[model samples]
Target: MPKLKTRKAAKKRYKTIGGKRFIRRKAFKGHLLEKKSPKQKKNLAKPVIVSKQDTKAIRIMLVC
Candidate 1:
């Protein structure tokens, strides 16, 4: 069997923590920051874990 290749984009955007959970950067904080409120911007700064529904797909993409 051929080895599975990790999705480069997913590998770059997502990270594994403690070899169990996947962490990713919050969205909507990359551009047009002037329009978003201070609180909203601050909240977006934190990283979030992948949802249960999406975790499976992400894990496949990451080859984990």
Candidate 2:
């Protein structure tokens, strides 16, 4: 049997919390802020949980 290697790219993008929930940065926060509203920019600053369907695949990538 062999151990699985952690995907560095995934490691940098996703974070595991309490071994159940996965947290990640919200998209569309970079650049082009001049046209975006204050509320939209504010919301993008927060981290969000990964979607249910995607969590399964993300978990595999985060495996230790």
Candidate 3:
């Protein structure tokens, strides 16, 4: 049988920690400090867990 290839797209977008999946928040691109509010900017610096409904699909994509 051929080796199962990992999904490159998923590998780039998602990260696995302690068997849980996390994805970085979108927006705040370039992280310019001249506009976005402190709270919004600080919040975007964190990683958020992928929802349970989406976990299955993400795992498939990640081959994890």
Candidate with top TM-score is 1
TM-score of each: 0.90, 0.86, 0.71
* Model 3 spans with C-alpha error above 4 angstroms: 1-3, 31-33
lDDT of 3 by residue, 1-64 (tens): 8766889988887888778756645655565776888887778777787788888888887767
Model 2 Cα lDDT, one tens digit per residue, 1-64: 8998888999999988888889999989889899999999999999999888999888889784
Sequence-dependent TM-score of model 3: 0.71
| Candidate 2 weakest lDDT stretch, 10 residues | 55-64
RMSD of 2: 1.3
On TM-score, who's better, 2 or 3?
2
For all candidates, what are the clash counts?
0, 0, 0
List runs of model 2 lying over 4 Å from the truth.
none
lDDT of 3 at 41: 76
